[model samples]
Target: MRTTRSRTVAALGVCSALVAGPLTAPAAADVADLRLDQWGLDTVGAAEVWEETRGSGVTVALLDTGVVTDHPDLDEVTVGPDLTGQDLSPDSDGYGVHGTMMAGIIAASGHGIEHTGGVMGVAPQAEILSIRVAAEADAAGGGETDPGALAAGIRHAVAEGVQVICIPLPDAAFSVQGDEAERDAVAHAVDNGVVVVASGGADGEAVYPAAYPGVLAVGSVGADGALSEFSSRGEHIALTAPGEEVTVLDADGGYTTVTGSDAAAAFTAGVAALIRAEYPQLQPEQVAEALTGGAVAPAAGAEQPGHGAGVLSAPGAMAAAGTTAESVPPFDPELAEQLADDPLVPRWVLWTGGAVLLVLLAVVGLVVLRRRSADPYGLGRRTPETERRPVRGRRRRGRGRRGVSR
Candidate 1:
């Protein structure tokens, strides 16, 4: 519970999109319409993105398992990496497979590769830099967890000068804390002006980067514009995105409806890309404002705080950015439904999210308990957890001598 959203805003530097709410599964008939670009806002942002911007000259950093570099639909995406390893698409496991789907939403280009599959990229012209860190989960529901790799990826992403960084993974526990490398990387990205987009964890507790003041913490919303059960809440969240049933290509060359903050994040990232693509003149801050401010509040009494401004509407966003799209009123559920009948988001997001929240509480409890044992005034506090004296070269006060007491 940190109260300040300043850091979250700085990190995301853009608005997050809220899903229309849980959607029905697409019928076989709907499958034919399946395209990676099937995000609800796809049509709305297309004109602005295609005519004004294709995410061209922009590189979005997908800091996740990894993007499917060789996918037919991902011609525009360029593979980038961290200290961990390669950017292998169609790889085994469920880990980074999600990354490809997320990337497709932001910058998939189905041309050149035949039958690129059900998903089409949102920002077809935008490029992607892969920052893979985690491994796919095994049947036992466990895989190698590597925060270091995540930290490395963040730094690498900043160094590479990515304009947007999508962090799909949630830190294990807020108490787990981020490694120095990760914090420094985020700081560097902010200093250099990279917009960071992250998902709110299943837990109500805000996760890092997302919780971190500069990051744009995002929660999930469904087709009805109601907050998804799985979407994390609280002050850390800066916006919401279409998280349920959105279609994207998997690493295994299949199309599936996904429901996670990750998918929502992808759509949000795409929206940001659309704005940047159209209004390169708009700074990250301005881009965020336009997206959040332009979003129509969900129905009356349905609005939630921390989700920020409102659900993203690409049409509204374009208008706000002054892209000259046709003048249109805020979102109307009936009108949107008429435009497309697809299901990428589901209602179970919350039921599944409860477990996650429990874990976060445990982490917080542990951290608090540990902190109580340590000396509160300890200046030796290091990052992550526990406490320690300053590293070598640092001096401690002796008698106000103001000199190194080494």
Candidate 2:
């Protein structure tokens, strides 16, 4: 097992080294031309929602490795305390790369890296509070993230009055069932009216924090609007967003693309920030419902196990009501008896209804059989022959012209 893990790390190192080449700054006009390349933003209708709110006055707490405070895209980010005990600066190189990537996806301003059109987050005006819980190397070293640090980070974010908390790292990095302390911390944040969003895991298994109640578990979708093959599948998923080949700013101030549920979760958090900023009176649960209820349905024939409510629709959510409908009350025998006594229809009416349904079914079956006979393909239905015929258009070359030219 140790040897296998070492080989995996070595392979990943080589790939990273190959892709981490120096980047050149592009002209300012290049940024404008590449606006459509931010497919994630376009997918969620971020531009329409931006007309109302760009997540102004919202603070999103990112719990992960750490962030690059100096990254031009993250100049507005506030670096929080490092709980990893590495004595690493918030903008430390190497260890905080993953956290920095997630942060850029949530709040990057497309500043310095704009040459590659840089990266623009869903909520460019939102503030990021960087809370370092673990380093990127810990996972590569075959060690799990410190559960204690994760729990502490949540509590700290809540105390700091952050409106949204994003945990892009999966719970598997710590435990299968998850750390009890971390679950409690997430619950505490929710209770305090802070929306907690977490990755639904890259593997097809339930992960912590996201699996916990009151926390929105976000899955991933590809640019084609299909569920990402690697996104975890489960009932815990609350919503999905584009994650495949998502552009993010590295700690070294370079642009790169990443694929995973983590990117989806960060984008969801940005949408949550937009909601919080637009509707300050909404509760956490209400915000979750708006996002889920307003989601755009996935494309037909797409496997939907990993996609919860479907693709995140920022404009739809912003346009939705801030409150979810009240749950129906529990069954009451007394009310049932009272309703039973006041039947809207006589008992004989039910018998008539059954007979009518049977007749309707027989008529439908007869129609289907007649249509199938006329349709040579037995498609169970019929279409006009003219409609099935291919419409022909004028040929580019006439027969006489073609022969003479030949």
Local error of candidate 1 at residue 349 (angstroms): 66
How far out, in Å, is residue 169 in model 2?
A: 0.5
Q: In model 2, where is the ten-residue run with the lowest total lDDT?
A: 1-10
Q: Which ten residues in a row have the lowest lDDT in candidate 1?
A: 1-10
Name model 2 segments beyond 4 Å from true: 1-26, 112-117, 137-143, 170-174, 321-406
Candidate 1 lDDT, 1-406, residue by residue in tens: 0111111111011111113332223322233355433655453345444666667767898877666655556776666653345344444444456577678777766532143323456677788888767554431323233657767887788788677888776334232255566677677777776777777766666566566655766777777678887677676676777777776665655555567776777777877777666665555666666777777676533555646667777777777876422332333435566556644454377557887899999999999878867956766556766656677786665665764564
Please, what is the TM-score per model?
A: 0.64, 0.70
- The local lDDT score (0 to 100) that residue 117 gets in candidate 2 is 40
Backbone clash total for model 2 is 1
Model 1 residue 51 CA deviation in Å: 2.7
User: In model 2, how large is the Cα lDDT of residue 148?
Assistant: 90
lDDT tens digits by residue: candidate 2, 47-144 = 78788888888999999888887665675788898887776885445656788788888887665333234457888889999998876743544324
lDDT of 1 at 311: 76
